[model samples]
Target: MGSSKAPSWSDQWGTGGLGSDNYEYEEGDKLKKSSSSNKMSSAKAAASAGMDKAKSAALVSADKAKSAAVVGAQKVKTGTFAGLKWFKNQYQKRSSK
Candidate 1:
């Protein structure tokens, strides 16, 4: 009767080492990213810039509204003072007569 030889470790696993040799990769190498990732980064940057612009515009609009309110208040005060002066002048003229 002939004695059959057992298979070696390399023959049972593979010659390339881990799994298959079809995949090409190296240790410590950065992983390749798809174009979609780059596109998303660009979109995020644009959105951030847009938000900054909107915030600046809102601040400017608020400042303008505050200035307008101050000017309107000044006008009302000036008009009331002028009316009081006119009334006092008329009363003095009538008493002297």
Candidate 2:
């Protein structure tokens, strides 16, 4: 008759053994998932910061444009008054002549 022997723990656990290839594969998969989430969070934060900077730049540009427009309007008002004075003096001279 053939001899009988008990199976070892590794034989019983088969692919699910603690130090087996399956265990390492599962651990690697978990690590990959964690790293992927970390990268996504980092990307989102960078995008948010970029948007804030763009908004601040746009607000500054708008303020500068408003100031320029006010200055231009003041110049136009001054020029118009000077022209009116010159026209009045010419008219007076013509009448006297």
Candidate 3:
């Protein structure tokens, strides 16, 4: 009968497991580099989203301010017209008396 030995960690990781110190170190370095890159990408995406939200808010505020200014101008024009009419009527009444 032939005897078989149990597979080691190096067999699973293709010579880059706990048994091989040099290969393990190299694999760890690669993993660290990849993780750092992923973190940087996530941060960049978040910053872009934040900037978009701020721009949208600014646009909404500007539109509201413009609308308010238009309404205010209309009110001022109506008030001035009403005041002038009242003044003319009073002046004519005083002149005729």
Candidate 4:
């Protein structure tokens, strides 16, 4: 059999074959770009869902805290009024004596 000449770099890479401003990329590169774009979209969707869940949890916690604060305020008000009434009764008894 005759000796075969090896293929040149230009022929293998398609550099000076098609035309100017026409660069050829491998199939693997195209597939990688597509797969990366899909992964990015999926990640964005997951992050958005997580943020919404966190926001709902924070709102529920805030509502519970507000209810507790209101109950505490009412108790303080009731205790203050009872103490004032006791003081007034003591003053009246002392004045009568």
Instruction: Supply the global lDDT for candidate 4.
Output: 0.70
Off by over 4 Å in 4: 1-35
Each candidate's lDDT (Cα)?
0.70, 0.70, 0.70, 0.70
lDDT of 2: 0.70
Cα distance off (Å), candidate 1, residue 68: 1.8
> TM-score-based ranking, best first?
4, 3, 2, 1
Cα shift from native, residue 72, model 4 (Å): 0.5
Tens-digit lDDT string for candidate 3 (1-97): 2443433444546644434433223332331112346666888899999999999999999999999999999999999999999999999999999
Residues 2-96 of candidate 2 have per-residue lDDT tens digits of: 54343345644655444433333333232111234666688889999999999999999999999999999999999999999999999999999
lDDT of 4 by residue, 1-97 (tens): 2544533445545654323223344554221112346666888999999999999999999999999999999999999999999999999999999
Backbone clash count, each prediction separately: 0, 0, 0, 0
Any idea how many clashes model 4 has?
0
Residue 19 lDDT in candidate 2: 47
lDDT of 3 at 39: 62
> Model 2 reaches what TM-score against the true structure?
0.58
The clash tally of candidate 2 reads 0
Cα deviation in Å at residue 57, candidate 3? 1.2
Q: Alpha-carbon error at 66 in model 3, in Å?
A: 0.6
Worst 10 residues of 3 by lDDT: 25-34
